[model samples]
Target: MRTPADFCADKDALLVPAVRIVVRIVGVEQQKQGDAHVLGATEPELKCGPGVDNDGYFDADTPLGPYYLAPDAAIRLLTYDEKAQRMGLTDPVPVATLRDVLKACKSGKQPGTPYTCSGGFFHAAMDTKGVITELTEIFQS
Candidate 1:
């Protein structure tokens, strides 16, 4: 298996489902502002996963390949698309409740992580457990 300490640098690390679950859970209680906020493990940005604002870190092992620490100001679902553009969905709606978001990430089907690439499109089913597992591997060891 791959550990977080095994990671290197200058590479695109993919976020896993399990990792997302853990971070999302811990992030909720963490700070929710500034760079250090998301990576603090108490910010809600944990749900941001690995791409946006990339704000999460881990000191683990990963002989599989290299990886870069996300950051500390990652964004979340509701924070991503403020104008829902998927599935005929128009207006901004905070559909993800704290309880459900946690349950889904743990269930292995997160379904969304918040992305406003288009400023109006909302893509669901964006799980991050994969990356979560990678960054959080050391804690287990």
Candidate 2:
């Protein structure tokens, strides 16, 4: 278990910040830990600092990026196209695409094929704990 001092030290390390990435979750599942959620995606994760750049898979060993979201993590569900427009993204992944994929995953159905779509991303600490401190989901007006 992490002691108070250990937690505090982790918090302090965030001041310098490590890395934040935008991950499009194609699937989600409750982890055995019960306190965390596992997210899977087909596309490479993108770094969300300074500029969006390729960050590779959350699991470098595998082609699919499977990441864990902390129990207290914040989650935001919003319209991807709208968020993309606001971000001045010329090409935006439609929310419907991600929705369908997630739906299939939840229903124990494999997606017909892999495709790229936009939903939201979480800022993770360098610790690899995959804790999301805050998240804001912006929807269409």
Highest lDDT: which candidate?
A: 2
After superposing candidate 1 on the true structure, give the runs of residues whose Cα lies further than 4 Å from its correct spot: 1-92, 95-98, 112-141
Using all chains and alpha carbons, the TM-scores for the candidates as numbered come to 0.20, 0.39
The best candidate by TM-score is 2
Error of 1 at 114 (Å): 9.3
Q: Model 2, 1-141: lDDT tens per residue?
A: 111223233444432333444344556677776556666743332223233223121222233466655555544333323434433222233334444655764566654433222233323333345454433331111
- Model 2 regions more than 4 Å off: 1-18, 42-64, 79-101, 104-128, 134-141
Q: Rate the local accuracy (lDDT) of all candidates.
A: 0.27, 0.39
Candidate 1 TM-score versus the reference: 0.20
Q: Please give the range of 10 consecutive residues that has the lowest summed lDDT in model 2.
A: 52-61
Compared with the true structure, model 2 gives a TM-score of: 0.39
